[model samples]
Target: MKSSIVIADDHPLMLKGMMNYLSSLGYNIVGSATDGSTAYNLIVKLKPKIAILDIRMPHKTGLEIAQDCKLNALDTKIILITFDKREDVYKKAKEHNIYGYILKEFAVEEIETCIENVICDRPYFSKELVPNLEKTYTNTDYTSLNKLTKTEIKILKQIANNKTSIEIADDLNVSPRTVDKHRSNIVNKLKLHGIHNGLFIWASQNKDIF
Candidate 1:
């Protein structure tokens, strides 16, 4: 079956370019919208097989719309598009299990590949953006981890370095309670839940992200 798709973007030219490109690929273009709210409404009503969404939009962000679709139990697979290669955007996309992320300029050429990979139930990160993701990790400072504040990174590095909470507190000139709060914030910001799982393990393995 052809993948039923809804295209959402604020720019008229971009919307047209994407719609034209995808339609030529023989996919069914179910609908198009200029903003996230309209897109969400159309998605709920049309129940498309997949959605191609721009990250920035008026009324609501594409990420917010994706969350709503998930909350409403819509079956549409989402392919989030972005112009900027922002790390926080990627983190949010990962947290939401978004099917694919393609840079807008590359969409005309790379989108077909992204859709195919997503249809095969695989995660698709644009080749143009992988280097940015790697850069985020490699350039992380104990002062500025991606999407994390300076204090958060310091606490995370301390944890990764096998420091106890009290040790971290003393080292950072904060109280143990404050250190614990920072730890909790770090875990939540990184979407790490449960015991002995999530970024704690990932961070330990990639110590340089600390």
Candidate 2:
């Protein structure tokens, strides 16, 4: 059976475009909303297989709604749609185990793939994030990355994206002290010793490579 879906976006045009596109593809759209509260109510009432939501909304953010779903143990998967490319937002989405995340810029093109992946129990993210950085810088050297561990690399990526230690810690669900310790390790691994904000500066300069 085709999976049932409920979608919400504060932007009327965006919501309509998404709804019409998905409906045309023969998916079962049980409900939709132009605001957060209404969207959450619709989800709670209808209990669709998937909820496609705009990340930021008037009454409740998409992350909050996802959290509520988790709190209730609702058997619905969440797909967050947004214009944000912030690592913090992505971290939050992952923290909530969002099934799909696509940038609005590629929403129409990526929607089908995202839905298919989510319904099949796979997670999907926008490809735009990669190309978005590519357009900014042509140097994509990843030589220095082999020396760092995955978690350290993730921290460095967030740092490169300009996230503070507190913000990174909060996003990664770790304490500030843990983040600081990681920072020290990162600085040592990357050999950015004796330079102020050297880790951050290197990450920013080679941000696209991350």
Best by lDDT: 2
Worst 10 residues of 2 by lDDT: 132-141
Candidate 1: where is the Cα deviation over 4 Å?
134-210
**Runs with alpha carbons beyond 4 Å of true place in candidate 2:** 130-210
Error of 1 at 61 (Å): 1.1
* TM-score quality measure for candidate 1: 0.64
Tell me the RMSD of model 1 versus the true structure.
Answer: 11.7
Q: How much does each candidate deviate from the true structure in C-alpha RMSD?
A: 11.7, 10.5
**Clash count list over all predictions:** 0, 0
lDDT per prediction? 0.77, 0.81
